[model samples]
Target chain A: MYVAVKGGERAIENAHRLLAHARRGDQSVPEVTLDQISEQLGLAVDRVMSEGSLYDRELAALAIKQARGDLIEAIFLVRAFRATLPRFGASEPVDTGAMRVQRRVSSTFKDIPGGQILGPTFDYTHRLLDPTLAEGFVPEAPATAEASTAATPRVTDILGRDGLIEPSPQAEAGASVGDLTREPLNFPADRDLRLQNLARGDEGFLLAMGYSTQRGYGRNHPFAGEIRFGEVEVEFAAEDVGFAVPLGAIELTECQMVNQFKGSATEAPSFTRGYGLAFGQSERKTMSMALVDRALRARELGEEALAPAQDEEFVMSHSDNVQATGFVEHLKLPHYVDFQSELGLLRKLRQEFAEANEAEPMKEAAE
Target chain B: MAVLAHAEAGEIAARLRSLALPDHQDLREPENGLVMLRGRIGGDGAPFNLGEATVSRAAVRLASGEVGFGYTLGRGREKARLIALCDALVQSRDFGAAVERDVIAPLREQLLARRRKVAAETAATKVDFYTMVRGEG
Candidate 1:
């Protein structure tokens, strides 16, 4: 006997209870603390912060725990939480130049003014797994005191001094440029929108796109002009005070790529630069981002624009992981109404074909 | 009652409030008929005709940006202006998501709850029971 099923509200409430139980698991087992997740799972926290666009590591750790370690879900949780936050005020741009250097490297120069501080990096480590870590392990601190007082000049800056690289344009002058978030993105977006999309884009997607450029898809002979990671002061101007105030500091990774460019008629030939900056120590993501940035600037670089990476409309429109994931997952929702319409059309088509075959008896007989 | 009515507004209004936009002063049935917007009419603003509409709107903004815009089904110019201001504030970077969640969502919920409460009360009072007894003629 078919009985009408009701109690959607009850089902939802019960399902939520079950989910809570599942998330908690066995009460006897030691619960993971937010501090442990933030400190121990530092990379995960960084990923969440970068994608979620929120700087709070503790909250990100909590989100990760609630999401069962699903980074995207954690990101979604952070984004949702962030959406509810009230508008405070806009912070003044952080000066990366004034960063308290922790890790700074330049591939273009062997020994720059401020000696290469290869702070804490996995670059020289072997990929072999350590069996001792199975029983748990703690890292010992290294004695370090080779500080340099010399200010580090950006590699691109040096190139700019010689008029080889393009000069960094003032962002304030570009304030009048329309924001993509405010208005729907039209074709041929400015560099700002493109950069914004790249900064918030899925790391894996950007990685693959950047890989394509290196493989001769949209080849631009590139060099890592400079890559720096450290703590930078974030300042904000209070309307009442009429002066900018420091709003603590944040760890950031900045990458600048120099590419060979020969200008055409409308523009002058100069060494073009691709820039990438993220919230934390995300070198690979930042480098890939820089490469993609350079590739996207093919038009401005006076090079023939030819690759999916160079297609501003395609890259900017499809780069958002949140939007991509939502549309992709939304297909899992009930689509019976649309399915019924499709089924009706298919049945009608099949019947028409059958009738047409029956009416062509002479043709069938001849065959 | 005013607070409840204010809460009935949606996340958009809350967002504006977070940006320091003024809370909506009051909501009243507009004397003028509502203008129901139809299909797109290019840059000629919203296309619409005369109709009855229940409109509510609020306003708020801080120094950094302008908050303007309002939504209404009726010809409530005040509501529309308030909503417009809210929209402007939401678009500003100064206003974060917290405003949308706290002020806006709660207000909307309250408004909806009030409407439902009023409707139920009116329905209960209008009840006219009729009992009939069957008998042999």
Candidate 2:
């Protein structure tokens, strides 16, 4: 009953040949280089890096090219390639406070310590397509204002000073958080694990889940306290090294959502926070992730878990697009024996019903 | 070290050519790997794994017994090896000052200049919002 189907080798080879032929459409046109993909199609590259959960731009670009611009497929390729590499060790927790701020904005306040920078944003751009872009239009650079003299502080820190926001829940002094890559994710995961899942989770999935909460699925109305995009240095301490060495800078997008938390019987009412951090300038991804992060905290904050976004198991399990795609696409594989058994049973049932009907008619006629 | 890791491979390699250096051998051959990146829960809370980054690290030992280690982000094995050699040279007595004058000082300057350029360009995009008074019109 469990037979292995073999010999699709010829068809598979033909399909691959067709694929390579199609991948390079219009052979006369100059082939898209890795530099072009990495530089021009940069946002696509960024998404792959963030969702793929790998931090190499060149690798992400290569994956994108190989997948023929299918971003999820590119992500799958990245995850596969990462499996073959050696893992050195975990880095020291990155310091977001000292980020060389390229873009920082606070939606809740009119003014923040570091003045708002709308660096290369699509926010204010009109939805209308620009025809000039196809012909390579370059705009003149804008004039500069003096850099901020005030000390840049994260909005959470400013709020935390007044005890306006509930202080971040402290882990035991030396408690280590779970890494999903190393250990299997069990239900009732900690905040750290949940954050890790969402950070690399599908952008569209989180966006939809977050949107559901806004439509009163499990409303935790959030105000975007701050969103910052910039680069920060990663420090890793190798074996036998007394000091941690800098492993170079990586860009990150971080979002902090401030949600109102009505107090419990003993605890005082204060604002709560949800945090999102991702690999590159994935602004939308980070914002959606932050929104969903707050919604999922219903159980922790003693609120009723009434929504899909609030369900930790549902969100965490389905958030990974790579796994979801695999399970869904596995339907294409052979299920011949299982289907044949079902077919046989249905046919037998129909035949028995027909025979019973014939005998009942004959008995009536004879009578 | 931060600047060195961030600097281009060509910039680093060219700096190494001028200095007359003793022979150095690899203690650890340059190898590509991944480093799991971690981030705090909030900006300042408990730590969590964010992702991993590609890195290449190498170590070199000079004839004089001075040991050097190099690490760089991404799969630049040659850059990692060159960095190791520079690290060892900077540690050694006779070549320390020369390596400092050639590599460290110049890379640091380049890093500063690049940072300044980004800061300036970002500053150009700084937004100053204005609100219309309803009664004025």
Candidate 3:
């Protein structure tokens, strides 16, 4: 018997109660602390921070716990929370040249200035799973050493010094660059706006687009100039102080790629650079970002842009994970109105076809 | 005929008001009450009639590079004139060039200053952030 079901509000409240119970499963087994998740599940925390566009590890850990380890859900929580925070002011751009080297590597050169550190990477690790780890074994700490004091010159800097790469232009100081969050995106965006959009873009989407470039779709021969992961001092300018003061330190992954450029008659041939930076150790995202960046510089490189990766509008417009996920998931919502309209159209078309077939013997014979 | 005469005069008066010109009472047409202003006469010269509009507009050019404009539903001549003046000032070459510094910056500063002043005046009755925390589950 089809009985009308009511009490939607009650059902929702009861479901919430059930969820609370489920989230606090096996209370006697002890709940996982935020610190444990932050430290132990460090990679997950990093991914959340990278995607969430927020640098709070503790909050990210809390979000993960609340979301029951759903990374996207955790990211959503962090992003939603970040929106509520009052904006005081923007921090001064960090001088990456003065970054205290931790893990730095270049795939192109055998040896560059500030020789590749390869710090805390799983690059050489074997894929074999350890049987001992199956029984919940504690990890052994690796021997620690002091950071290299030797100054690492940027790959682009070397090219710039030799007039091989395009010289970086200085942006006008104190220019009121419009905030992306506040304003809707318009076409023909400046480099600063593009970089800001890319920084907060979805990792997977960027990775795929970046991958396409490597797989011969707008392929640009890129050399990993330098990929570095380290803690950088974040500074903000104070009204009273003439100089900027250090606010705190944040862990960042930065990647710079040097690509070959063929100049045209009007322009001189020089090397170009693609840059990417993300919060925490996200090498894949950073590398993909760099490749995509290089592909986007096709016009500057004097290359015929024929690939999807080279299309700035297509890549930037579709790269947002939040918008993509929202629209994709919204299909699950009530679409009966559209479905009914489509159903009516299909029925009418079929009936018309049947009537036409019956009426025209000549058309039927031709078919 | 009387009703039509009254309506025509009312429409003319409205148009004159919209153009930011004074409606002369004595200059009303004898056959109809339509107020007429002579061309090239008053300060608000070259009056052109707008048959109908549900909106009123104002433009002002500020001293800064920012031009301020206001539009509201329904005809309000004075309000529209004030808004238009503000918009004209804002859109003026001198003020419009540095919109952020001249307009938005000052506006934000003024708002913040006013809020602070109000807060100070009501400091004794200030509500604590923790007040809501106690009520939360």
Candidate 4:
């Protein structure tokens, strides 16, 4: 009865074998290819890439397949792999203004320049599932337009020209950007570091934080001034050529939120801004990021930090799902030795207490 | 360059093979391997492992000693070899223009057409929202 649970290696080995068998399921059915997952289960791949902070679709698809389609597990797998990679030279900050925008919309204005292009969204679609799609379905292609070189003027630019909104950060050429990978996060982080943390933070966690802010916690009158999804060219400095060369283009989602700032006693009323950018078509993630980003800026804005989201230390420290999952799942591991020591101490304390009670009764009888 | 990045390595290889370039040797044999993709929180935040990606890389040298390297996203040995050959040809003084004109130019047009097709399809479903100025009047 007291025998300790031993020989876990064999069990573990067998369990792995069973897992492999289960992963393959039926022998007759064709195995799911990485391309199939990358293209067909594209949204899942996007989520893994977004959360995993990696953009390589093939790798994300592979991770998804290995993790049995578990997004978080796939993210963990990706994160582990990412830890081992070497860093290449950083590219120049992408120009979102020049983005070949596929979907650009604004809730703040009824209409704006380049007009609202709701490229592809499920915002107005019914949630009903079509059972017929189980057989097969192919989406019809859409109409196209010739690519325009004209830059899309930001909505904020209109207000900025009049000095109505707070002045945006001036682009400082060759400014030293902090690398989160190389440095441990220190609290009271600068805007750059905080935004970085939020970008890679768990989507669900950020969504909840964002939701809390909207429910009057750190209430800000956020108007999604603009949300855009499209491809932007990444450029790297070509030292030999004396100018940056366009390395490639990657899809990105950018959101700019404008909030009405009712001026405090010392400051004048003006519009404030919160920005979010993420890999791929991550509208919800990007939008939620914008809200949280704004909420976290309470201290900078001279506003009271009265909300959970406003506490930068709290938000950044526990935002990572991998860290959270590890700490939680660690409880399942063997703690028998630690438990046994506690049991021994409890027994000794009980024995001493019993003897003291017996001695007190004898002394009372003698007296 | 963007076309190469987005295009499948196998497709690139097929195109390169069809070019029928002069004899070349593998400077570095096409090696199928994995590259770990790293990520950062918020972009500038602390780094975390995103995952490993399968990749194939090769380097080729033309008879004239012009060397070229090719790195592709997945395990496509033939694709890698072809890309490497194209890379070498691109560096060759005599063949560079021809390669760019025949290969890259066509690839770019094809990629653009594909993108336009998708954009057109998506535009068909575009929705416009409007609001009424209520009361005050």
Identify the leading candidate in terms of lDDT.
Answer: 2
True contacts kept of each: 0.00, 0.79, 0.00, 0.14
**Clash pairs, model 2 backbone:** none
Task: Specify the CAPRI tier of model 3.
Answer: incorrect
Q: Where does model 1 exceed 4 Å of error? A: A1-8, A172-174, A264-269, A362-367, B1-137
Write the residue-wise lDDT of candidate 1 on A98-186 in tens digits.
66666677788766666566666787789789887776677664443424457866677677778877676554533543334346877
DockQ of each: 0.01, 0.78, 0.01, 0.24
Candidate 3 global lDDT = 0.60
What's the TM-score of candidate 1 when only chain A is evaluated?
Answer: 0.91
Report how far off residue A118 is in candidate 4 (Å): 1.6
Best-to-worst order by DockQ is: 2, 4, 1, 3
Q: In order, what lDDT does every prediction score?
A: 0.62, 0.90, 0.60, 0.73
Q: Give the TM-score, chain B only, in order for the candidates.
A: 0.42, 0.94, 0.29, 0.82
Winner by lDDT between candidate 4 and candidate 1: 4
After superposing the true interface residues, what Cα RMSD does each candidate give?
A: 25.5, 1.3, 28.5, 6.2
TM-score of each: 0.69, 0.97, 0.66, 0.84
Which 10 residues in a row give candidate 2 chain A its minimum summed lDDT? A142-151
Which ranges of candidate 4 are over 4 A from the true structure? A1-6, A26-29, A138-151, A171-174, A238-245, A262-268, A352-367, B20-88, B128-137
**How do all the candidates rank in terms of TM-score, highest first?**
2, 4, 1, 3
lDDT for each residue of candidate 3 in B40-93, tens digit (9 for 90 to 100): 101011111101112223334333434334332223434434433433443555
Error of 1 at B96 (Å): 34
Ranking by lDDT: 2, 4, 1, 3
TM for candidate 4 is 0.84
Q: What is the C-alpha RMSD of each candidate to the true structure, in Å?
A: 23.1, 1.5, 22.7, 4.7
Clashes of each: 27, 0, 28, 20
**DockQ of the two-chain complex in candidate 1:** 0.01
Number of backbone clashes in candidate 4: 20
